[model samples]
Target: MSTRREARVTAARAIRSHAEDVVRAALVALPPRERTRRGLAFHAYQRQVRTIMRADPVAFEVVETRMLAEGHRTSVIEVTLRGEVGVDAGDMLHVLWRNDLDRIAAADAVTAARFWTTPIPHRPSRWARVGASGLLESVVDLSASTDSDPARAERITPRFFTVAGVEASDVRLQVTHTAGMPPRAASFLARVRPGDVVEARVLPHPHRVAHDGPGLAVVTGSGAAGVFAALRAGASGIRLVWGLGDKQLAPWVQEELREHLRAGRLSSLRLALRPERVTDLLVDEPIEQMAWIYVSGHESMGAAVDAALRARLGESVLREMSDGLRCIVST
Candidate 1:
């Protein structure tokens, strides 16, 4: 058989095996009275299993498998499948199990004949409202008040903004990270347009900031992490502004900068030790011209940038700041 066909067959088998294991364990866990002839639990589980077995086998692929933390002998498998088949299978498995629980907890005997299933609740799609007025206005807070950890903050944001038929080229993003905070909401960087801007200061660890297209990037820090992040993001034009104190770049960073400078991708390099200086540089351009602005890191620096932008653009600009390290986003 062909490799693709073999993979599909294997995936089908894995899904079937997983489904059977879960059903069998759940059935076994029920008390003797719950499994008696008059009970609907056994029949419901059997029907669900049969439905799973009759599903289009080639349509499903098991992507991840993990044991339940509840210490149940059964395992949960995350499946990637086409169309409504996956949804139907999930409803059967999850709702059938829940129905059995409801039957057990009820004062009156609840049978399968009376079991009512509810559709799974889905998150509302609000992507249409994004950039509706030819600009993007949103605040991604990674401070203690919202989500303290940048990694956790990334998880809360949608991985793709295409749900409402928005294309990558339709939006531009300007992101700035400061005060040693890990880059938050960097996933959106993957969709940033050519003219988008990215700026960072003191990235302690390597983070994926790579852009899908060439854009402008600015890095201000003594460490090389910020510069490396900008380079990885495929920035066609890069400007490095040195941070506070007399700091020297690592030998490798210096070498990389020189190479990019020779190639014309690294456009300008300078020094801006004070936060006020950085703020001045950030607001050098007209705020009304940009589509979106995301500022994060030190509260003082964020406030400074916010004040500068508001001062320049006045009420025409929309700005929001969160607690902890003030993060400002303007449109």
Candidate 2:
């Protein structure tokens, strides 16, 4: 007889396999009209397929499997869904399944390589344009503000975790791409093209300056949303801390930021490995002066940096934001 663990693994795999088949069948049977009405659900299942072709089986690697009380069992699977053209890099699918009474309760695709449990609603994208080194920018326009002048351009809300731009009455966004993206974010990236005039929503918020004093901006994967916010707010001194893996999009981004450094808009820029501690970037009197801080990056590293910043600078001075590995650290 097989061990209890063995039986659970086998059962979990079977459940996952059947679920994949059902999703595929549902997608194939979905007509154009039905897709329009239930596009959200159908599109979601379409993305769950790991292979490039719809006919291929979903490739799920069992990362971990565990048994629970009441005959319940859990399985964590790593899924990789490749795009026809391609994604930036490090894109894969992650999901958890609970098996009980021969039925499985499936969860939403976590989508991010890093652990980002929080889910945010995504508005339809107005426009999408691709830039250097696999950088995809999603644009959303708030159009004109009713509370303020219609002719005057409205500025984007400066939220630490999200990257956005507002110029000429347009709001631009650059989501930090990784190996695997959330279902909604991936679908947005896949369908968006330049000058398409798509529909999308704009997340609004109150804008605030980096801080009362000089600030240090630490970023990992984002295209420097915080830095732009700081400059727009007329920050005098700014620093950039960055890191990346094999797919280094930073070098291309650094060129754009260089002009700011040369123009004296930035005080300093440091590139370090993800494993390095945030405190290593501190130098001279800045540590003691209580500089305002922003840290953004992968959930794992970002959390570590946040902890370190809080320890070194305290919670009052440090700010952080991210959607999984998609993050932009800034002041």
The candidate that wins on TM-score is 2
What is the per-residue lDDT of model 2 for residues 131-198, given as tens digits with 9 covering 90 to 100?
Answer: 21111011111211211111121212112223232333333333433334322332233333444332
Query: How many clashing pairs does model 1 include?
Result: 1
The sequence of per-residue lDDT tens digits that candidate 1 reaches over residues 54-96 is: 3322212222221111112211111111222212100211111
The estimated TM-scores of all candidates read: 0.29, 0.42
Q: Candidate 1 has what TM-score?
A: 0.29
Worst 10 residues of 2 by lDDT: 1-10
Superpose all Cα atoms of candidate 2 onto the true structure and report the RMSD in Å to 1 decimal: 21.3
> Candidate 1: where are CA atoms >4 Å away?
1-227, 240-242, 274-276, 280-296, 314-331
- Candidate 2 yields a Cα-based lDDT of 0.35
- Residue 139 in model 1: lDDT: 20
